[model samples]
Target: MRLLEAFRGTAIQLPNRIAMAPMTRGRADDTTGVPHPMTAEYYAQRASAGLIVSEGVWIDQAGKSGPGIPGLVTAQHAEAWRQVTEAVHEKGGRIFAQLWHAGRVAHPGVTGRTPVAPSAVRQAGRIFSAEGWTDTVEPRALGEEEVGEVVRDFAGAARRAVEAGFDGVELHGANGYLIQQFLAGNTNRREDRYGGSVAARLAFPLEVVAAVVEQVGAAKVALRISPGNPENDIVEDDGKEVYSRLLAELRRYELAYLHVIDTPDTEALSYLRPLWPGTLVANLRSEEPTSREEGELLIGSGLADVVAFGRLFIANPDLPTRFALDAPLARADHDVYYGARLDGYTDFPAFDPDPAKFACSARS
Candidate 1:
């Protein structure tokens, strides 16, 4: 029953230790980058999770990655997200918004501006656009002054998320985004204070975290990191040294929780777990799917305070309930995962104990 145990997080108390990992479903309004009505319905359906981390939400127009991604730049965008947070809260669930900036992963077709990164290095692949997948353009290196502006932008976005009623904000420092680009040496080749040594690489990311925590107290902020992850063409030589220095500085912030993605080498979680003083949320990256037994072992062993499940939560709206009852989980359909319709977004039904004898089926 470790998965069902209540967790005391920095910002809010979780009803259970099972969190819904953030996943982009591409169901937002394409033009304005606002979340669709169905997006609220989609999250409300899975409000049973201890904590619902929303899909990556753009912090500004220039930060947008592609079509169908949500933003928090304007009042309208905040209003749209308010509906989602309210829906989750009405069901007695807590939720956090994952504030994101794609950096070099963006394309002009998506953001109408040349992508910016710590360095001019471009990702090794194409990104989705209105015209379909297009080659990634070499990003312009951000000016020394511009870095501070981006930090302020994150603080502004954090304020907007709180205004929208989100319990907290999880700064997306993982997945080779803007933050990770600064952390990885292969992506950042600058000689400025933002790059070179471990302290220099950790400077910008730490500034961003400090800015966000200043806007909304440290208790209302969390960070997600993926050390040694080469996704989006990121390459890091020494993840241990980088993350050790990074977490050592981060320990002073006393944020809500540190959500770590298990690296393919499986060394990150084990190496950085002890460095983090607060709650730790681990997303196991394995060939096999996560199960109740695995979750129990992780929690029981004190390796992870909470466990996040991505695809499993997509198919099972009542994931915690299903785990509690040991019920069969529904398989997810990958085809409609990013479609702009409810077919695969909010249509996944909660588990039924006796479907043949259910009232709706009997009436049908």
Candidate 2:
């Protein structure tokens, strides 16, 4: 099966093309922003995945997005993540730390400071905090000098991730985060060298990538992007032009991989497939549940080198095994997905080899 074939990435080789996509579960320690012990167990339980991209890890206190999210800023945070990485590694799984900066999506109620973005604009949404849901505040426009500091922060975070025992780092440029805030035209209204046109807007994101590559080398870094996504109130009039320039510039870096979230029906996959010269990880979005069949088709057609499964991996820790056996997947519990306990985190059982026969035989 093409989906089960080995994939040689930039800095790591995977046993298969199935990757556990990064999903925010909000189960970290609220005060320290360290991942909970259960977090380590949770990831280790799913270590059979070819690659495990961790949840969005804040680079600094100022860039924190919400409560219960992990960070990579302090020695304590790194130490905590070391256990998680070690657990995965012991199981022969490769993991990547997804470096993130929330930008305007961060609520002052959560971070105790005003968020910063490319422009002083407030996205139309509410952010969850300890107090409850609070409206997103208008972010301060980052000064050109501050932009350099942000780039350094990302690079520093990448270094910290490696120290934390991660194989590499994935820059979270997708889903209208800080990098996407700079990429999307609606959120970025600055007239400086960092905004206005496509190339200008691409400046900060590309600079961030370059700084990260320089710090940790290109082979150890990956980038995630979602063009024309309306999430976080982002609107781009010309996604094709923006991504075209972005991808063309990115080709020179020869980074690890380009992770794009698009459905089979979207024009993004078609337009971006040829632009990127490196390995491509495609997260297919669909109204229905993602299936092994679809993943095989995506790999067989040469559209993606790796397929990432988010919700499925949540409910089925041994998802690849279940796919091999053609077993039914367990449904995820939405209510317990972000809870602090083990109900939905690590309590999901692996598939039984013979449910009916086992039950009858036990009774007999």
Candidate 3:
């Protein structure tokens, strides 16, 4: 099947076209923001994926979204992540760090820093924090100068990611995070150069891309965008104009790839696929476990160069093998989706076909 075929993308060559989607598994050190040692084994187990995007890693302390999320701000954090990258590399896998900043989505109770957005608007729902789930608050609006600092922070984080042994860095500009908060029409209500017209709203994300590319070369940089996604209470009225211009301008960088998230509400592929010429990583996002059929269709039809699977990767560490053999997939436990415990993390086993092979171990 095309899904299991080799990928010839310039960003990273692969034995197969199956890519592991970046999922926020709360298994890192909450205090130090370092990746847990088991993080290495967790990623290494799924090295068969064509490309693995590390979980959403915060760019700085102030940009932290919740407890247990990894960071790429300091030398210590880089050292810890180096182990993760090395482990993946040992298994012949290529991995990229997803540089993230939660922006208004960050709760002060979680990171001890006030959430900053393009505007002083409040999110209407509850968010995770130290005290558990709590009501979201009105975020502090970043001044023009402070916005420049955020851009610098992204560039700095990208440098740290390469030092951490990553093949590249994927800027988290999707899912209503910091970059999207600046790009989206509703959240960015400022009249400054950063937010006003189409160019203004696209300015922050474009600037972030440029800064990261400058830190690391364009080949070492990629971007993710979800134009029509409304997660985190985001509403985009002129998504077509915003994304059309954003993708058009992004052409200058000749980025490694463009990861796009598609949902029932958004026709991201129908509109975005034609705009991007580089490697296209398409994610058919859903809460349900991923099946080979979903990815096969995307790859067979040439809509996406690679398909990223999230929930399926949780239970099937040998997802590519199982896909090749048509093995029965395992169900993931939603309860343990986020936590430091390894119960629902690394405990998932590969698909074993020979029943007699484990007969003695099962009795023991």
Off by over 4 Å in 1: 355-364
lDDT of each: 0.90, 0.88, 0.89
Give residue 340's lDDT in candidate 2 (0 to 100).
57
Cα error, residue 51 of model 3, in Å, equals 0.5
Write down the RMSD of all candidates, one decimal each: 2.7, 2.4, 2.5
For candidate 3, the TM-score is 0.96
**lDDT ranking of the models:** 1, 3, 2
Candidate 2 clash pair list: none
Candidate 2 residue lDDT tens string, 1-364: 7777899866558899999998888888888898988788899989999999999999978888887899999999999999999999999998999999999989888888999999999889788887888777899999999999999999999999998899999999998899999999899999999999889999999999999999889988999998877778989788889998999999898787889988544457778988887899988777666789989988988888999988898899999888887777777867876645657888898777798954654466
Tens digits of lDDT, candidate 1, 224-300: 99999888998989888999999999989879899999845846877788888789998887766677888898899
Off by over 4 Å in 2: 355-364
Pitting candidate 2 against candidate 3, the one with the higher lDDT is 3
Question: Which lDDT tens digits does candidate 3 get at residues 117-196?
Answer: 99998887999987899999889999999999999999999999998899999999898888999888789999999887
TM-score of each: 0.96, 0.95, 0.96
What lDDT does candidate 3 reach at residue 208? 93
Pairwise lDDT winner, candidates 1 and 2: 1
